[model samples]
Target: MALGRNISPGQGAKYYRKDDYYIEKEGGEEHKLEWGGKLARDLGLQGKVDAETWEKALQGHFPGGVEIQGGSMVDPKTGERCHRAGTDFEFSAPKSVSIQALVFGDERLLQAHKEAAAEAMAFLEEQVGARRGHAGKTWETTGQALTAYSRSCWTPILPHDGQ
Candidate 1:
C-alpha cells in the first residue's frame, strides 16, 4: 500500500530526521536514496537529505544563484510562490511480502518496493503542474519536486493463541 500528501513549509521540519528511526528499527540497515529526479540533481541536492538543504529546496533556494519564493522568481527565473514545500510519500509492501523479506533477511524485497515507489513519484512529477506568473495573469507549468525516502515500518497484526 502507498499513500502521499502535499507537505507544507511548516510541516517540513518534522520530516527532517530522514529515516533515522527507520534505520534503527531495521537493524541499522540504511535506506537508500531512491527518489528525487533531475531537478534535484541539477540543484546539487544529493545524498542523505539534511535539514538545511531540505528547507532550502522547499523555499526554492538552489545552488548556482537561484532563489524561488512562492514558486516564482523574476527575469532569469520567473514564477509565483508555491504553497507546497513538497510531497510526503509512503510506499508499503503487502504483509506477505514484508514477512518474506523479514523471514529471509532479503534486502532485495525492500529494494524492489523502493524502486517501485521511485518510479511512481517520477511519473507523478512529470504530470504535476505548478502555478507561474503574477497573480492576475498566472499560468500553469510543470512542477519540479524533490522527494526523500523518509522511513519504513511494518507492524503486523496476527491472530495468536498467546504461545
Candidate 2:
C-alpha cells in the first residue's frame, strides 16, 4: 500500500507530516517544490500564519495594492519581473493607548496594515479610472482615508528637509 496524507482546504497553507512540513507557495507549483521539511523549518518561518488566511483577508475583503502573489516581484527602477520566495510575517498591535482602542489590542495591526494598503490602492485606482474616462470616483473619501492610512503607516521616522 502507498503511503498518503489526506488534504484539507486550509492545509494548503502549511501541510505537515512526519515531523516535517510541506509548505506550498503561490508559484511553488512552477518551482516544482515537492516538500520543504526540516531544511525550511531551519530557516525560521515558525508557521505563525497561513497564506490562505492572509490572502482571503486582504483580496477578498479589500483587493489590490502591490499585487504580492505567486512569489513574483517587480523591479521599481527598471520595471522588471523577478522571482522571490519565502513568507512575510509580523506581529502587530494597535499602537494606540486609548481605552476604546485597547479592546482590539495588538491583533489588529496586520489587518489594519492590509486594510489601509487596500484603501490607498483603491483610491489610486479610482483616480486612474477617472483620468481614463471612468466616472463615480469620489475625492472626498479618498482624501481622508487614503491620506490617513499613508500617514499612519509611512510616517517619517527621520528628521530631514524636503531640500
Candidate 3:
C-alpha cells in the first residue's frame, strides 16, 4: 500500500538527512536518493537531496523570478504569499512480501519493491500540480518527489505477522 502526507517548511531535511527508519546493513546503514519528475531535472537537482536545494524547491523558488522570504514565496503576479511546501509519498510493501524478503535474505526482492515504488511514484508525478490563481487555475509540476527505500524494524513483532 501507498500513503502520503505534506512536508512543511524546514521539515524537508528530515526525509533526506534522517535514516532512522530504514533498513540496516553490514558495517553500516545506507539510503539512496533519487529525484523524480521533469522539473527536478530542469532544476539540475541530481545525485542527493541537499537541504538548501530542498528548501528552495519547497518554497517554489524557481529561476523564473520567484521570491522567497520568511519561509514563504511571494506571488509575482498578485503579491500574495504562498506557504505550501512538498508532499511525502510513502510506498510500502505488503507484510507477507516484507517478511519473505527478510526471512529469505533476498536483496533482489527488496530491490524489486524499490523499483516498483519508483514506477508508481513516476505515475503519481504526472498527476501532481500547483495551483496558480484564485479562479482554480493549476499547472503541472514535477512534484519534486524524492524516492528512497525505508524499512522499520524497531517493533518487537511485525504488525502484519498476526501475533
Candidate 4:
C-alpha cells in the first residue's frame, strides 16, 4: 500500500523541512504569507514568523498603516502623504528662526530707538524750557548794554585814557 502525504504539517516538521514554519503554525494563505514576510523583513521586525503577527506588529509600529493599504504617495518635504507597505522615507528636520536675528535685526529695534530719541528730546526740553519768540535778540541786546556800561566805568581808571 502507498503512504499518504502530510499536506498541512506542524511547525517542527515545517522547520525541519526548511519551509515556512510560522506560516504553517498560523495557517496563513500562501500569497499573504509571501508578501507579509517580505514587508516584515524589510521593516526589520523581529519575531514576525507569520502573517498575523507581522500585520499586528506593523499596525503597532505605524498607526496609519491602514490608510496606505495598497500604497501611498507622500511629499518628501511635508511628510504628508500615503505610504505603501515597506516604503521607507527619509526623515526631515523642522525649520526654525534664529532668536538673535529676530530680536536684534527686526523692526522692533527701530521702534525702540525712535522712542529713546523722543525721550531724550523731551528731557532736554524740560531742562532748557521751550524757546519763546525773539529770545535770541533780547539776550544779545542785554549782553551788549552790559559790555558798554562796564567799558565807560573803567575808562577813567586807565592812565593813557586820563592823559
Candidate 5:
C-alpha cells in the first residue's frame, strides 16, 4: 500500500491519514501513532528506512530530474505539427506587412533575422524618435539610426507622418 505520514490538523493534514504512516518525525513534530485500532505491525508495514534511503528511492520515480516534459503529453499517433504566430513579417519591403516570418538555423536565415530586427527598430524610431535627455553612458543601434536620447540636444529628428 502507498502509505504516508499522519500530519497534524491544518498542517498538511489533507495529504496524511492515521492509517498510512510512512515516514518518521517531520517539522519538529513526530507523526501521531495509535495502537490496537491501527499500528505499524497491524498494517504489515513495520519496515524502517532512513531519510537518505527514502530520498534515493523517491528519485527513482522521476525521470530527467523534477521537470515534467510538456511535449511528452502529446499523443505520438495523432499529433503531427506545432504552430507559431507573429505580428508582422520583416526583412522585406511590403506596404502594411502582416504575416508570419518563420526562421530556421541557417546563415541566410540569421542574416534575415538581423535585417528584420533592424527594420522593426527603424519603424519604432519613426513612431517615437529619440529625444534629448541626460546620461553619462548611452546606447546606439548597429546602423547610424535608433540612437539613445541622452546628453545636450536641440530638436527631434522626426520622421514623416506616414504608416
Candidate 6:
C-alpha cells in the first residue's frame, strides 16, 4: 500500500482509506479512486495490483538515474586563455597622486585638511591601543576607520550623473 493510507478526512469531503484509496466530494458530487489511480488507469491497469508488483514497476519507470560528465578542457602549458595578446593589453606602473587637491583648494583649507587627517589618525591609533593584545580586534578596528574615511572621500569623486 502507499504511504499515509490511514482512513482520514481531508479538506472538503475528501477521505483517505487504508488501501491508499480516496473519496472526494465537490459541490455534493462524489468521486472515488486509488492513490495514483488515475495515472494507473490511464496506463490501462483496470484494477488494483499487488504492492510488490506496483512498486517494482514504479521503480523501473522512476526518473531517478542521471549521469553528468565534467568536460572542461585545460591546457597544461600556459594556464588559461586570454582574449587579447601583448599589444591589445598593456600594463603601466601605478602613479601616486597628492591628496591636497582632493581635500583642499587653498592654503587655509590645506591647514584644515591636515588637522582633520591628524585627528582621524590619532583616533584610529587610540582605538588600536584600546584593542591591545587582541591582534584581530586591532586590525578590524583600524580597517573600519580606514574604510569609513575612504568611502567619505571617494563618494564625491564618483560619477553620479547618469545613476
- Candidate whose lDDT is highest: 1
lDDT of 6 by residue, 1-163 (tens): 0111111111111112222333223322222322222223344443333333333332223223322111122222345432210011111111221244444534554455445654654454445312434457643342221111111122223333220
Best-fitting candidate, measured by TM-score? 1
lDDT of 2 by residue, 90-120 (tens): 2232445222334555436545665654554
Q: Give the per-residue lDDT of model 3 (tens digit) for 1-81.
A: 778765555455543444432322223434344445666666565554444555566666754564433235454345666
TM per prediction: 0.63, 0.21, 0.59, 0.17, 0.18, 0.19
Give the lowest summed-lDDT range of ten residues in model 6: 84-93
User: Positional deviation of 47 in candidate 2, in angstroms?
Assistant: 21
Clashes of 1: 9
TM-score rank order: 1, 3, 2, 6, 5, 4
Scored by CA lDDT, what does every candidate get? 0.58, 0.31, 0.54, 0.29, 0.28, 0.28
**lDDT score, candidate 4, position 36:** 22
The worst-scoring run of ten residues by lDDT in candidate 1 lies at 71-80
Error of 2 at 68 (Å): 23
- Predict model 1's lDDT versus the native: 0.58
| RMSD in order of candidates | 9.3, 18.0, 8.2, 45.4, 29.3, 33.0
lDDT of 2 at 87: 24
lDDT (Cα, tens digit) per residue for candidate 1, span 2-36: 67765556455444433443223233446433336
Those runs of model 1 whose alpha carbons end farther than 4 Å from true positions after fitting are: 18-35, 70-82, 132-143, 150-163
Which ranges in model 5 have alpha carbons more than 4 Å from their true place? 1-105, 129-163
lDDT of 1 at 92: 80
- In candidate 2, how many clashes are counted? 1
